[model samples]
Target: MLIKQIIIRKKAQEIEKKSPYILLFHCSGLTSRQWRQLKNILCTFQGRTLFQPSCRGKLPYKKKQGGFIAQFAFSAGPTCILYLIRKTPDNTWSQLLPSAFYKQNLVLLYGQLQSTLVNHMDIKRAVDLETVSVFQQLFELIFYPYNSLCFCLNQPIQAE
Candidate 1:
């Protein structure tokens, strides 16, 4: 059963080459080692950049995942700045936000609001909370001033 599960996961990862724009936000507490499989799979394709700048090996801050994805975007030869909205709702994923909505959404994404999907996902509540908190802090400190594009990817489940 474990072997079957691993095979399925690998197949899914391997087959995701179609959507180049997919934003991969790593779940926290997982090391870069966990990303090795993804890196290896991405290496097979040409003209694709698989950049993992910060591994946090012997770093001062805790080992969290956020800016690795954002930093890659910043370094991808773009001129504008970017802000990574780690906890924004799924709506923000598909559309642009107004000035007021941007500010408010940024706060809500970074805050511990029960209304957010972070509190209701299938994952453990404690783990989700810590991951969201870490994502907010690291994203602000590392990916700031790059507000040319603000990104948020939220996955909400139906209550039924």
Candidate 2:
């Protein structure tokens, strides 16, 4: 029984590694400490892995914001996305976001996670898909720039 249990656990770990990874980047006035409770609640599931970094000090990157973005891009591969959870004063979520470039995909999610805009599962399903929206024009294919516009967002888009 012990041997069987060990084998099962190993298999589960392997499956978890292959599962989708989501990085919930905390907004301004928030830190990794704030996410401690939430991480415990969200990471309990085996569907995906979550990482929230300590956005406290200055990073080596040119842009401080790029630090978290770089981490998510490298760790989660191309399928990784930085979820900006911004809640406005009037109670409605803000949609206007500054233009930014990422090695992978960028999703602007309005409102809180558990609220009305989006949920956890919705993100998993979307990233796991082949083709996704860029929310604008000028789609630059990272890997094969000459190939076509239809690029697989789920596949790993590593930095060259």
Candidate 3:
């Protein structure tokens, strides 16, 4: 019985190691299909598998089932940026910067915000002076191209 348990564990480990998780995020108002062209490029690469989410903004697989290994985006070139949104003590939403920088090849930028009223979906219809101002600030901080991708974890970041 002990030997069988050990063998089962080993098989699970092997399955986990077989594929690296890659998260693809498209800019606001765009669908995950924004990465369709890039997916074609990555599919040709060796040892890479593509998993499309059943619904937009929803991850296809659970994290414990081998969480994402890397995040990829196409800008001027292949770039990876980590964006974080955190609730502040002032009872407002704001962006947080990563403590450590990413690799030179990876191209990660960091920025912070004091507060914002709009969440993800509402950014489009943010007509209020304050909401529109916050939206402008976000775009200025991270000028995500129409077809670009972003990386975020934990709570879902809005994308069509």
Candidate 4:
């Protein structure tokens, strides 16, 4: 469920009082100095913000599930990924996306997750196979298209 990239259909400046705010969550795996990109993205949204304090733990998942879920990255090992979430009115979301978004973005992203999972775990364990399967399942739980605003948007949005 790692969020590799954010694809906002609208420009940051377009967010109005009625629009949902985009909250960028940078995982602890991301160093403080590396937040330049996240900062830029935030600035595009006019720099409105709220703060929550979280420090990394040496034991990975021992104390960071909240952060991991927020950023969609697993805090299991050295492997880390960039990620993003979009909030739209559930109509223009998909229409605004490229045709091959799932194929090009999601499929490739899942492949990377499997690759990283292989690197982190001791495959010799009998449960590793199940672990991978569950990972795929949970991954879907996080990024399922059905949950997206643009899940089914063939019809045009009617203007108010």
Candidate 5:
């Protein structure tokens, strides 16, 4: 199974030069190593740009869950910048104010709130919350500026 997966990935990489943007979404519990592998494969095959965002919770086997979170946005050049965010344990949302920093590179946002922002399909439009605290924090981060073209991947029942 592993060998077959690798072979398929190599074939995919060979053909990625034709696609404009490749958006990948993974569940919340992936390790940094797995994310790195996916990033490498995408970078190698797609020959375009790649971005991966950290989840709200700590990845399994990771030490710190909420500090120096690394986010990426790739372009067609040799230079790349690692956009870092600091997650607070207090559950307060710290707005990473958009600057001229992220003017380029296609921004691909993930997470629950991202779905509503991208597709305009509000979950809250369907379900109501009586005492919503964390939901507010989540929304603030998702609906912030500079994240106009967000895309949400369907959440998997089990982490891959």
Candidate 6:
């Protein structure tokens, strides 16, 4: 798996203590740089770490044959989340779920994973399929109605 690491300094230790690390694994045909740029623009919260792993269908491996699989790793304090993103022959993206749907299941996973941390805390979290407008789609994809304290966004790409 090709991995790109991004580290952001926390403004306050209190924020870091409350924040949960987020891992956003995007689909194929997009470079880690693109994801990083989007993250920098959309993510305003502090004391968080981001990881973008370049899957097999992307750069340095796009030209190569066979299927591409990649994983994104996020670490915050003692908590960590892992999201997987893959590539399709047509270059589209999707989440890896039994039903292969985008909306409900993604949100279910997000809520299920971070329920304890987000119970009393107002932290926003979400996941969805990326649309045409990269920036707008990114924002829409992560607009969660839960907490406002910390935000955890996860995007997984499926080659279909």
Best by TM-score: 5
| Candidate 1 deviant stretches above 4 angstroms | 1-19, 51-155, 158-160
RMSD after Cα superposition, model 6? 16.2
Residues 50-140, candidate 3: write the lDDT tens digits: 4422224645343543233222221233233232122133311231222211111112111212233222322112122120101122333
Ranking by lDDT: 1, 2, 5, 4, 3, 6
Candidate 1 TM-score to native: 0.28
lDDT of each: 0.32, 0.32, 0.29, 0.29, 0.31, 0.28
lDDT of 1 by residue, 43-122 (tens): 44444444333344654323455444433322323221122322344454244234323333232212123555422211
TM per prediction: 0.28, 0.24, 0.22, 0.23, 0.29, 0.21
- Which lDDT value does model 2 have at 78? 21
lDDT of 4 by residue, 1-160 (tens): 1122233213233333223322222213443333434444443443343232233554344465444333423332232222223433434334323432332232111111332322222211212121111122323433543322122122232222
Pairs of residues clashing in candidate 4: 3-82, 3-83, 4-82, 4-83, 90-149
Candidate 6 Cα deviation (angstroms), residue 76: 27
Highest lDDT: give the candidate number.
1
Mind giving the per-residue lDDT tens digits that candidate 2 earns over 1-160? 3454344345334433442222332222223333333344344445433433334576555365545434433332122223233222332212212232323334322222322222222322222212122433313322232222222222334322
TM-score of 3: 0.22
Off by over 4 Å in 6: 1-21, 31-33, 52-160
Comparison by TM-score, 1 against 4, better one: 1
